[model samples]
Target: MDPTIRNAKLQDIEFVLSGIREIFKIENDIFVYSEKKKLARNAIRDKHIRVAMRGDKPIGFSWFKIGDLTPFGLDYGKWSRKYCWISFVYVLKNYRNKGIGSLLYEDIMRICKRKKVKQIMLDVFTVNKKSARFHERIGFKPLLSIFTMRAR
Candidate 1:
């Protein structure tokens, strides 16, 4: 059976946190679970999350936010007033490559169209080639590159 996508609720906090933890593990990044929990709470309250459910269990989710481009010092009002930033899209390890992620992305695209968003952006770690390729396959092109270094 195919999973259905729906907006996440406060009750889904634990599942969202678990997915974020899994992402951190894959990227070898450090994080404070409490902080992530707070962010997830806010995202849910703002209706910025879409969860893919199989029966009663959440198998994947996508989190995103829409904002005006002018705030970033890009004063191209004629070009685009709003943009979307996809923060995360995660599927359970056991259920990957099964098109759940694509379904989650399609849900976001529908929302963006309804909201008149001009562009969508997302970040993928350079080490995560699989994710980058997936995004590419979904028609996301690289606009810029961000690099980070640890200051010793």
Candidate 2:
């Protein structure tokens, strides 16, 4: 059976943390579980987060935020009135390739449409070609390239 998508709740913290851990592992980034937990709590409370559930188990999730571009000095009226930035979309390894991620995105799309969001944006790591391709397949175009240099 397919997973169902629903808004995340504080009760889902552990599952969300596990998903964040997996993402950090994939990115080779370091994180403290306690700190990540705090961020996850805040995300659940402040941002728009949705989880994919198969029965009672959480299998995947997507995180995003809605805001206006006017804060960034782009006061273009309706064009900049509303937008969405997808921060993360992840599925458990075992549940991947089964359309759970797409289902989560479909939920986000429905929310955006209801809110009249003008644009949706997201950042994919250069090393994660799979995610970049998925975004492209979903009609997301590259708007800018970001580069970073690590110092020793």
Give the alpha-carbon lDDT of every model.
Answer: 0.88, 0.83
Clashing pairs in 1: none
Write the residue-wise lDDT of candidate 2 on 73-128 in tens digits: 53334554578878789998898888788888889999999998878877788878
lDDT of 2: 0.83
Model 2 TM: 0.86
Q: Candidate 2, residue 113: CA error in Å?
A: 0.5
Q: Lowest-scoring 10 consecutive residues by lDDT in candidate 1?
A: 70-79
Cα lDDT, model 1, residue 117: 88
Clash pairs, model 2 backbone: none
User: Which candidate number has the best lDDT?
Assistant: 1
RMSD of 1: 2.8
How many clashing pairs does model 2 include? 0
